[model samples]
Target: MMQTFLDLKAKQPEDLPSIIKIAFGLAAFFPPVKSEIRLDFFDDQLNEVQKEAVSFALEATDLALIHGPPGTGKTQTLIEIIRQLAARDLKILVCGPSNISVDNIADKLGPFRIPMVRIGHPARLLPSVISTSLDVAIKYSSGGMLVNDIRKEMDEKLNTSKKTRNGTERRKLWEDIRDLRKECKVRERRCTEDIVRASKVVLSTLHGAGGRDIIRQNFDVVIIDEAGQALEAQSLIPLVRGPSKCILAGDHLQLPPTIPRTDKTSSLRKLELSLFERIIKLHGPLIKRTLSVQYRMHEMIMKYPSIGLYDSLLLADVSVRSHLLSDLPNVIKTDETQEPLVFWDTNPHGGFGEDDTGAHESKSNAMEAALCRYHLRNLLEAGVQPKDIAIITPYNAQVALLSGLIKSEFPDEFSEIEIGSVDGFQGREKEAILLSLVRSNEKKEVGFLADERRLNGICLLQNSHFLGTVP
Candidate 1:
C-alpha cells in the first residue's frame, strides 16, 4: 500500500483531495460539483455548517473535510452522509484510529440494516454487532458447493410454492436461512477474504484495512473518523486501498497524533502533524466547515476556549447548558465570585525521569496527587456523584499515582471515579474535572507540558466545576 501511494504521488493524480494537494504539491484544481443533492433518508434539520458539510460531501468528487469542535454532532452528520451514499448503492469503507471509533459508527448505523461489516477481532468488538463481525462474513460467504445446493433448493421450493401459495414450502425456506445463520455463529473464529468481498461497507482501524487477504479490494468511498489522531502514513493505508473520494472528520485543535519519543528537537516530530491538521494548515479555515454551536460546556466554562482557541466562534446552546453544579463554598477562590474555572498554582517539586520502559516519562508529584484526592473527597462529600468527577493528567505515571491514591484513600468510593491520561480521556465528559499538571520542578522546565491542545482538550469535555494545577 505504501508503494502504491508513493507511486501515485509520483504520478501526481489530477483529482486528489486537499490533503493530497499538500502531500504531493499537485497544481490540479477541480471545482466543487455544483449539482444540487438532497437526502430523503434523513429527516432532521441540519445546522448551517452541517448542511454545508453534507452538500460538500455529496457534491465534491475527491474529498471533503469537516472541522468538528466538541459536541458538534460529527457522528450524526457522518451517519446521515453514509445513509445518502448507501442509498445510491455506493460501497463505503469506514475507518478510524481505534476500534472504539470504528465500532461507534458501526453501532450507530447497524440498526438501519445496511450491508455493513465491522472487521476486527471479535473479542474487541461490541457484542451487539457480532452478527456483522468479520467472522460471520467469512463463515457464510464460502463453501460454494453447499451454498449452491442451499440456493438451488430454496429456488426450487419458491417456484413450486408460487403456484400453490403453500405455507409449508415457505416454512422450509425460512428454516434454511435460520440454519445458515446458526452456521455463521458456529464458525465465528474463522476469517477469510470473503468477509471484505461480501460486505458493502467495511469498518476497521487504519491498519486493519491493510489486512493481507483483503488488500486487492476497492471501495467507492472511504470515510475516516478521528482523522486528527492518525499519523500521515497510517491514514494513507486506507486512502490507497480505493479511489480518492474520501471524508475526513475530526478536530485538529483538540488532540494531534501522540509521538512517544522524547527527542523534541528531532526531525522525526514532523510525522506528528496528522494528515487532517496538515490539510487544514495549508488550505486555511475556508476549506472545511466548522461546527460552531457547542453543547458540552457552561457559558462560563466555554469562555476561555472560545476566546483563545476558536476565535470566539463557539456559542453556548442554552438548552444543553442547564445542567450546572452548586458551587463549593471555599474550595474554589477566584477574582470573580462565581467563576467555575479554578487554577491551583502549586509549587514545582518534581521533574521528568526515566520509567521502567527506559523512556523519559513525566514524574508524579505527591503534592499534586494529594491535592487531587482532597478535591475529589470534597466533591463527593458535597453530594456530587462519584461518576460525575474525572481526574486527568498528561503523564501515564501520574495517572497510575493518582488512581492508586484515590483507591487507597477512598476504597468504597474508588469504583466510580474515572482517572486517566488526557489522551485516554478524549471524547468523554464529566461534571467536575480535576486536572493534575504533573510537571513541577525548580528549573522551570515544563517538558511536553506546553502544548495548547491539552487546554483545548479541557474545552472538549463537559464543564461545571473545573480544578486545574499550574506549575
Candidate 2:
C-alpha cells in the first residue's frame, strides 16, 4: 500500500484528480460544486435529517462527511446514498475498516438488486457474505470453468504422485501439477477483472481497496463507513484512487483508531487520529452533516450521553422512546428489572472491592462478577432470552471471571450469553446490557474508563434495559 501511494505521488500534478490533490494537500480551497441532477429516493422512510444527508452527498463535488452517532441509522442512510448514486449510473466504491463492516453494507444492498461485488479473502468474511464475494463471482463465471478443470487435473496428478512408488513417475506428475496451478492463476485473474468491470458497486475494507486486482479500476465516488475507527493512512488508500467525490460516515464521539500501547512514538500517535476526525476538526459544518435521530436506545438510556457527548442533539425515535423489557408479554419484572437504567453500587467500605491478586495485574472483583451473574439469572428467569443479553466490562480479567462464573452457575443455559470487553462490543447492541466496572482501589483510579469515548460507547450499547455495576 505504501508503494501504491509513492507511485501515486510520483505522478505529475496535471494527471491527478481533484479529490486526490485535495487529499494530498496540493490543491487550494474551493467551495463545493453542487450538481443539479435530480436524485431518486429508494427508501421514503428516511427522516428529514437523513434525507438532507443523502442530498448533500449527491450534490457535493469533492468531499462530504456524515456525522452519525450510535443508532442513528448511518448504514441505512449510506445505503440510500448508494442506491441514488447507482441510479445515476455512477460507479461506487464502498468501504470500511473491517470485513464485518463491509459485509454489513453488502448484505443490506442485496434487496436493492444493485450490481455489487465484495473483495476480500473468504476466511475473513462472514458466511452470509461469501456468496457475494469476488471469489464466488469468479467461480460462477465462464472463465472460472476453465480454472476449475485445470484444478481438477492438478488434484488428479497430486493423487497419482502420492500413490506412485517410482521416483520418475512422481516427479513427472508433480511438474504437471505445478504447470496446471500456474494456468489456474492466469485464468482466475481474468475472471476477477471481468467480474469487477461488470459490477457497478465495489465493496471492501480500506486495505482491501489497494489489492492488485482492482487497484487500477477508477470509481466515480467513494463512501467509507465507520471512518472514524480507521487510521488516516488506511482511509487514504481508497481516497487516492481518483474518485471525484468522497463521503465518510462515522461518529468521532464513539471509538477512535485502536493503537497498541507499545506504539508510543510521536509519529504513531499522530497516525491514531483518523481522517474523519481530522477533516471534521478542520472543516466543521462547511462539509459535514449530523444525524440527530436514533432508533436503538430508549430515551432514558440515551439521555445521559445525548446531553454530555452529543450536546443534547441526539433523540430517540417515537417507537423506542418508552420501550422496555417489562413490556414484553412473558417478562416478569420486579422494581429493579422494570427501569431502563439500574445501578448496583458495590461500596468498597462495605467489603466489596476490586483486586488483582490472581488476575496478573488486570483488575477483577469477585463481588461484581457474582452480582453480574445474579442479574443474568434474574433476566433469564424473567423471560429474557440469553441471546438478547450481553455482559460488558472494562477489563479482560473481569470478562474471563464473569464468563467462568456464568458457565458454572448455569451450565446448560450459558452458551448464548455474550461476554466481552467494551472494545469488542463497539458496534453491537442488545435488548439488555450488564456492565461491570472493575476498578475499586485506595487511589480511586478508573484506568481506561477515564477516556470519555469509552464511557460514551458504554452508555449507548443497550436498547431497553441497562444494569451497571459501579465500584
Candidate 3:
C-alpha cells in the first residue's frame, strides 16, 4: 500500500488529494482554507467550542485537528461534522485506532438516520453496532437475500447427500453443492460491493481501512477518532485514499500508541509519536482547535487533572459538578466526607507492599487486590450495579489477580464488572473506577507509572467517583 501511494505521488500527483501531499511532505503545509459554505446547526445541545470545531472541520480544505480533553464530547462533535459533510452529499470515511473507538462513533451516529456502514469482522463489533456491520447490511440487501436462498438450497442438498446410499447419486449431489457454493461466493462479493458504493459513510479501524472492499471506494472526507493513539503509518492508510478534507480528533494528553518496550531504536521511538500530535506540534493553533469543556467527570474529580494536565482550561458542566456515588438513592457512603477522590496507601507500612515473586516478574500486590474486592462488595451492597463499575490496573499480572479475587468472592454477581489495563480502558467510561497502582518497594521505584500519558488515561476512566490503591 505504501508503494502504491508513492507510485501515485510520482506519476499522478494531480490525482492525489492535497491532504495526502501535505502529510507526505510532498507539498508545502498551508493553513486551513476558509470556505464560504454556511450550514445550519443540526444539534442545539452543542457547546460553543464544539460548534466552532464543527464549523472549522467544514471550512478546512486540507487538514483540521480537534484536541478533545477527556469527556469533552469529542465523539459528539465528530458526529456533527460527519452529518454536515454528508448533508453536502460527500462520501465520508471514519477511521479509529481501535475497534471500540469506531463502534463508539457508529453507536452515536446510529440514531442520526445516516446511511452509514461499518466495515470489520462481525465478531469484533459491539452488539449495538452488529446491525450496521457489513455482513448484517449485506444479509438484508437484495443480493444478500439471493445468496441466502442459494445457501439454503446448498444446505438441503448436503443433508440429502449425507443420507443417500448410492455412490453415483451422492457424487452428483456433492457436485451440485459445490456449484451452488461458488455461486454464493460470487453473489456475496457483488452484494458487498453494492453496499459499499451506496453508503454515505464507511467506518473501520485504521488497518481495516486498507481492506480491498474499502480501498476501491472514494471518500470526500476522512475523519479519524482517537488519532493520537494511532501510529503515523497506520493513520496514513485511510488518508492515502485521496480524501479532499481530513479531520483528526483525540487527546494527545492521554495514552499514546503502544510501542514495544524492547524496541529502543531511534526509529521505533519516533514512530511512537502519533500523527495527530506531530501536526499540532508543527503547526501550533493554526490547524487545530481544543475542546475546553468536559461533561463526564465530577468537578472535584476533574479538579486536579484539569489544572495539572489541561492548564486549568478543562471545566465540568454544571450538571455533573457535584456528582458523587452517595448522591444515588439507598447508596452507602464509603467515607464521612464523601469525597469523590479517595486514596488508600498500599506501601509496606500502610496497606500492602508490591511483589513480583509469584507473578512471573509482572507486578501484583495481594493487599491491593483484597482492597479492590472489598470496594466492589461495598458498592454492590450499596446499590451499584456491576456493569457501572470497572477495575483498572497498569499491569496484566495485577489485572489477573483482581479478576481471580472478584470471581472467588462474588462468583456470579460481579462477573459483569470489567477488569483490565489502563490502555484497555481508553475511550471508555464507567460510573465508578477502582484503580490499583501496583508498584511499591524500599527504593520507591515508580517503573512505567512514570508515563504521564498513561496517568492521564487513568484519570478519565471514571465518571462520578474514583478510588485508588497507591504505593
Candidate 4:
C-alpha cells in the first residue's frame, strides 16, 4: 500500500505541488448553471458560514478545504454540496481515511435518497447503509432478479444433491451446482462493475477505492471527511481516482495521522503530516475556511481549544452555550456554580509500565477508576441515561483497566456508557463526559499525556469533567 502511494506520488502531476497550484487557482472551473444554486434538500437553512463554503465549492475549479471543527455540521454541509454537484449531473467520489468516517457520510447521504454505493466490508458499515453495499450495487446494476435467480438455482441444486440417493445423479447434481456457483460469481463481478460505472456518488475508504473495478472511474468532485487523521499516502490513494475537485473536511488541531513509532525517521513517517495539515500550514488558510460556529461543546468545554488551538476562531452556537446539564447531580459538580467541568485530583502514585504489547502504557490508577464508578452511579441516580456519559482516557491499557473495573463493580450500571482511549473516542460525543486523566505520578514526567492534540480530544465534548492529574 505504501509503495502504491509512493508510485502514485511520483507519477502525480508535479508531485502534489502542481495539483495544489491548480486546486488553489481562483478560476471558475464549474460553469454557471442556468438556475441559481438552491439548497432545498436541507431541512434547515444553512448558516451563513456554511452557505459561503458551499458557494465556494460549487464555483471553485481546484482544491477546497472545509475546516469543520467538531460539531460544526461538516457532514451536513458535505451532503448539501454533494446534492448540488449531482444536480449538475456530476459524479462524486466520497471517501475518507477510515471505514467509520466513510460510513458516516454514507449514512447521512442515505436520507437524501441519492444514487450511491458504499464499497467496503459490509460488516464495518451500519445496516441502514448496507443496502448500498457492493453486493447490492452489483445486484442493482446487473439486475437483481438475474442474480437472485442464479443464486436460487444454486441453492435448489445443492438441496437436491443433499436428498439424492443415487451416486450418478448426485455427481451430476454437484456438477450443475458448481456451474451455477461459477455463473453467480461471474454475474456478481459484472454487476459490481456496472454499479461502479453508474453510481452518481461512490463511497469508499481510501484503500477500498483502489479496487480494479473502480480504477478507471473518475469523479467531478472528491470529498474526504476527517482528512486530518489520515496519513498523506492514505489520502492520495483515493484522490488518484479521477477527481477534478477535492473537498477536505477535518480539524487538524485535534488528531494527526497515526504513524508507527518504529518508522520515526523513515520516509513513510515523513508523510505523517496529513494532506490537510500540510495544505493549511503551507497555504496559511488561503485555500481553507474555518467553520467558526460549533454547536457541540459548551462554552466552558470549547474554551481551551478555541483560544489556544484555533486562535479563538471557534464560537459556541447560541443553543450550545445555553445548554446546561440541569439535571446534573450535585456530586458531579465541582462547585456551587454548577459548572460541569471538574479536575478531580486523585494524586495517584502509579507510573508507566510496558504491557504485553511492549508499548509504554499508563498504569491504571485504582483511585481514579473507583472515582469514575462513583461519578457514573451518581449521574444515573440523578436520572442521566447510561448512554449520555462517556469515560475518556489517553491510554488503551487504562481503558482496559477502567472497563474491567466498571463491569466488576457496577455490573449493570451505565452499561451504555463508553470507555475508550481518546483516539478511539474521536468524532464522538456525550452529554456529560467523565475523563480519567490516568497520569498520576510524583515526578510529573508526562508521556503521551503531554500531546496537545490528544488533549484537544478532551475539548471535543459538550459538558465534561476531567479528574486526576500528574501531581
Candidate 5:
C-alpha cells in the first residue's frame, strides 16, 4: 500500500484525483475543531469546573447548567468537554439561540469528523433538512428560513410564486423569480434530508429550532451557548427534544434573555437562578453545574462591568490568571462624560429633525467613524495588529454602516476586521467596543425584547438624563 501510494503521489501533477486531493487538503490545512464534537479529550487537562461539568453532563440524562461570571471561559470549557466525549465516542449536537451563535460554534468546531447543521432564521431550518435529503443543488446564504418559522414562510413563498404576472415588465418578473418570489419553492430547489442526516454536529440558533420535531432525533446532546440570553420558556421547549441531556453556558451579567428588562420578573429570572433554584422548580434536586475561571479581559476594563455582577466570582482580583496583556487598550471612560459618545436621533419628532433614510445612515456612520479613528491611532501607537481592533453595534443596521465606513476609510488598515452585535461579541473582546444607543422611548419601559421597541426607546425618549447614569 505504501509503495502504491508513493507511486500515486509521484504522478500527482499529471493525475486527476491525486492533484485534486492535494489541492483540497492544502486549502483547508487543519482548522480548530469544535472540541465538543471530538470523541476524546484529556480530562485531566480540563480545570476542575470543566471536568465536573463533563462528567455530570454525560452521566445525567437531564441537564447541566454551566453558569458563570463574564470573561470566564465557559464556552471554551464546553468545547473541551465535547472533545472528551468524542474521545469516548459520543455524538453531540451544539446549538445556540441565534445565527451568530451557530456561526461562532461552527467556526470553532469545523475540523472534527462530525456531521453538521446550522439553523438560524425561521426560514432555513426545514429548508436545510430538505436540501440535504434530496441532495438538491440549491444553496441558501442569508435571508432564509429558520426551523420553527419555515412552515409558514414556505407557505407564504409558495402562495407568492403562484401569482399571475401578466402586466409586469421582463426585468421586474425576472427579479421576482430569481428571489423565489413570495413562495420560496425550497423543496423543489434542493436535497433537504441528506444535509441533516449526514452530519454528527448540528449548530442552530435557539429562537428558531425549538419545539421542532426533526431536531429532537438527530443528535444525543444539545448544548446551549449563552443560555442567559434565552427566555425561560425557550429553554424548556428545547429540553423535550428526545429527552436529551442539556448543557447551558452563559455570562448572565453581560446580558439576559431576550425578554424586556421589566419582564425580567417572572420566568426569565426564575429560569436564570442558580441550579439550586431550578432544582426546586423541578421534581428533584438540581442536576449538575460548572464554572470557568479564565479571564480574557484587561484588568482595568474588567473593573467597570465586573464591579457589579462578577464581584462575587473573584474576577476582580488582579492576581487571578488573565488572557489579556493590556488593560483598557484605548480610551478609559473614568468619567462617564469623558467617554466619547455619539448619540443620534432618527425619529422626526426627536430633537434632531429626521430624514429617516439618511439619519440612520448618518448616525451609524458618524459613531463608527469616530470609533475607527480612535482604534486606528491607538493600536498603531501601541503597535498592535489592525485586526486586533473591532467595532461592535447593537443591531444589523449599525453593523452595515460601520462595515461600509471601514471599507471606505481604512480599507487597507482593517481589511479583515469584523463588525458584530452585542450577542456576537459575547465570549470575545477587543481593544475597544463602541456601543450605539439606536433605540429610544418616551418613558421607562421594563422589558421589550424586539429591536423595534429598542429603536423606539433610543429615537423617542431622546432624553439622556433618563438612565441616571447620564447627568
Candidate 6:
C-alpha cells in the first residue's frame, strides 16, 4: 500500500468525488464543491416507493411536503439530506416551530467549528461555544421576558418617601428587593445571549414571519421540519424570503395554527374579515416538493394514511412493518391499559356550513368537554405519567374549567394541561394527543390565523379597544 501525493492525484476521476466527500467530513476547512447545492432528500438505500416520493419533492417548483405518522423517521430523513448535501458543501438554514427542533439538528451537525452568523441580531455568539454568553444562552425566552421592571418602578415610587421606615425589617425588605433586581438584570443578559448566539439553525416559536424574510437572509437551502402542523401561510413566509430550495415536512393530518377570537367570532374568522379579505397569500403548489414514504409505524398503521395518496393498502410482513388501523388497537397499545384517543376536526358554519364562525357554540364546547374527559380518563386508567399526557384545546379560556375538572378527578394522572390551540403545541411531543376541534363547521378558520389586525388576537385587544367606550 505504498501511496504518494502523486499517486493520490492520479486516482480515477470517479474516485475524486468519494475522496472529496470523505475529506469534507474530516477536514477542518474547505471550499464548497458547488456554488450552491439544493437537494430535496439524501438517502442511498431508499425503497423504490420512498425514492419516487423524494423525487416528486425535488422536481417541485414552489413547495414540497413530506408527511406521515410520528416516529416515522421524518426528522432523521431530513438529517440524512443535510448530511449528504453538506458533503457537497451546501450551506443550510434550518428553522422549526420551537427551539427543540433546532437543537436536534445542531446535535446531528456535531462539532461545528465556525459560528453561525449574519441572519438576525448582532454578529458574534452571545455565549462562547463552550459557554453561552451568561448575558445570553437562555433567559425568559417566553415573550414579555418576565423581568422585574417592578424593581425600578418601585424604586421610583419610593423616591418621595423621605421618612423611610427605620425598622430592621424594612431595611431587610429593601435590600432583598435590590438583590432581586440585580438577579433579573443578570438573567435577562443570559437570555439575550442565548437567543442571539444560539446558532444559525434557530429553533424559534414561529412568531409571525414570512417566506420573503427567510430568503432575504441568504439561505441557499431551507428545510422546515414539521411543516404540516403549521399553517400554509406561516410556513411559506420563509419561502417568500427566497431560499433557492425549500422543503416542508410534516403530516397534514396534524394540527395547524390557531387564530384567536371571541363573543361572536373566532380570532382567525375575525381576521378574515380584516386582512385576507383583500387576497389570500401562499399555498403549497405555489412552492415545490414533498416526501411521503414513512419508515416507521407497522404495516397496518401505514395502510389507512396511505389511502390518501394511494388507492389500495400496502404492507410488508417484515419486522419494520406499517401498523394498519384495524391492527393499531393491539399494535400501538403496548401497555394493557393504554388509553383511547378522541379527535375531532369538524367544521363550524352557517349557510350550510359555508362560514367558519367560532362564536360560542354549544356543540363545539360540549364535544370538547366530552373528548377531554375521554382522553384524560383513558390516560389515567393506562397509568401514563401525568406530565406525559396533554389535552390540546383551541382556546385559552376554552380549557381552564376542563383542566380544573381533570385536576379534580385525576389530579395525579393528567396534570400537564396545554391550552390555546394547535400552534401552541408545536415542537412538543406527548405520549399521545387528543385534539379538540373547536371550529369544524368547515369555514377554514386556520387561514385567518395570520391576519395582522385581528383584535381578539395576541395583545389584550378587547380591553385596549373598549377602554374609552366604557362609562
lDDT of 2 by residue, 1-471 (tens): 696578677889877777666555566435466567665688989999999888888888788889999899999999999998998899999999989889999999988889989899888888888888998988888898889999999988999889999999988898998899888998888888888988999999999899877787899999999998988888888876678899999988887888765535546667768888887666566768899999988899999889998899998999889989998778887875589899887878766788756423667899889988988988988898888899999888889999899999988778899999998898798999999998877778786688888889899888899999777
For model 1, the run of ten residues with the poorest summed lDDT: 349-358
Q: Which candidate achieves the best TM-score against the true structure? A: 2
* 1-471 per-residue lDDT for model 5 (tens digits): 233334445653444232122222322212112244433445345666666666656655444566555445565677776765556555566756565565656655545544555544435435324332212211452223333255455455456546846545544545655564334545322234445444555565654444242343455666777665665445443443333455667644445445443534465545444322333234222433536354444344444344443443434334433323233345233323132223333332443221134422322334334444554455445544556555555556756766777677777776756566655555555533444434333332212334332322222111111111110
How close to the true structure is residue 105 of candidate 3, measured as C-alpha lDDT? 94
Q: In model 6, where do residues sit more than 4 Å from their true spots?
A: 1-71, 96-217, 226-243, 251-290, 293-305, 308-358, 361-384, 392-398, 416-423, 426-429, 432-471
Model 4, global lDDT: 0.73
Which residue pairs collide, candidate 3?
none
Error of 3 at 326 (Å): 1.6
Question: Sorted by lDDT, highest first, which candidate order results?
Answer: 2, 3, 1, 4, 5, 6
Q: Which 10 successive residues of model 5 have the least lDDT summed?
A: 462-471
Runs in model 3 lying further than 4 Å from the true structure? 1-17, 24-28, 33-38, 148-187, 263-267, 333-337, 349-351, 358-360, 377-385
Q: 153-192 in candidate 1: lDDT tens per residue?
A: 6566556656656688667766776675566444332335
Local accuracy of candidate 3 as per-residue lDDT tens digits, 1-471: 475457465757666767866665566666656567666899989999999898888888789999998789998899999999989999999999889999999999999889999999999999999999999998888999999999999999999999999999999999999999999988888889889999999999998888877977888889999999998888988877577889999988898888876635546777778989888776677788889888888888887778888899888888878888878777777662266888888887774888756423678888888988988888888787788889999988999998888988888776689999988887688988999998887888877788788888888878888999778
lDDT of 4 by residue, 291-345 (tens): 8888886777788888988899888888777565654454333341255566655
| For model 2, the run of ten residues with the poorest summed lDDT | 22-31
Which model is ahead, 1 or 6, in terms of TM-score?
1
Whose TM-score is higher: candidate 2's or candidate 4's?
A: 2
Q: Estimate candidate 3's RMSD in Å.
A: 3.5
Model 6 lDDT, residue 1, Cα: 12
Query: Roughly what TM-score does model 4 have, to 2 decimal places?
Result: 0.84
RMSD of 2: 2.9
